[model samples]
Target: MPQGPLFLARAVYRRRRLRDAARLLPVFGLLLLLLPAFGEQSGNLAHTAIYLFAVWALLILAACLLAPALSRSEAEGDPETDQGPQDMGDS
Candidate 1:
């Protein structure tokens, strides 16, 4: 028996990881924002607010960055498949 390469194309692998990151970003942000609530200093509204805002900003930035990469990846993957609604030729 012979062994074969176990890795995907670099572009495909990166696209998949990026997509995973994009999907998990909200959950990550949620966990971070909730962390303050579980801490001993939960009464400090100012700190919590600042943490929430920072997380929000990071999430927004991540989304902005991922959007273009994802769109570009999809564009690179297949153009023919994404074109919507072929003609039925009823004419």
Candidate 2:
């Protein structure tokens, strides 16, 4: 019963915060795609496209920067059950 790297990855991804963040990524991408539609309403297609592209790029960069911090915080908050000080002399 040996688990592979994929199993380990899935386990880490199951963390609540990480899972929520993963779910939000697709929704964010969808919003980015839909942004052009809203810009069209403003009657300045080119400007709107440029603005949305910049916004989309910035958001992706932010997400990449924040993802590692999120994982580190989650790891820190979860206590390791296998390693801890044990009481002695009271068997």
Candidate 3:
């Protein structure tokens, strides 16, 4: 029997996943921010502030870690490109 089709190379696969995560980061952050609203309304301003700060810090760290890999992938000339309109009237 023939083997299954080959999977994507590890680097490409990892970069694609990273791109996905980068795209989803904002939505993830929003959900995390909303998490406290779903919990008990303890009315403790300090604890809520701490949670918000922690979430903000985590999002920043995640972006920092992902930025390098994402930039490297772009520098490598990823196959997907935005093919804009070909006709621009002025030179």
1-91 in candidate 2: lDDT tens per residue?
4343544443444555575776687688778777777654757767876877887887788689668867776676533333578566666
Tell me the deviation in Å of residue 75 in model 1: 0.8
Per TM-score, the best of the predicted structures is: 3
Expressed as tens digits, the lDDT of each residue in 1-91 for candidate 3 is 4454388667767778988999999999999999999988876889999999999999999999999989998888544343556455755
TM-score of each: 0.73, 0.47, 0.75
By TM-score rank, best first, the candidates go 3, 1, 2
For residue 9, give model 2's deviation from the true position in Å. 21
- Per-residue lDDT, model 2, residue 65, is 67
Give the clash count for model 3: 0
In model 1, which residue pairs have backbone atoms overlapping below 3 Å? none
The model with the greater lDDT, 1 or 2, is 1
Report every candidate's CA lDDT. 0.81, 0.67, 0.85
Error of 2 at 45 (Å): 2.4
Model 1 regions lying over 4 Å from their true place: 1-5, 41-43, 78-91
Candidate 2 is scored at a TM of 0.47
Worst 10 residues of 2 by lDDT: 2-11
Which prediction has more favorable lDDT, 2 or 3? Answer: 3
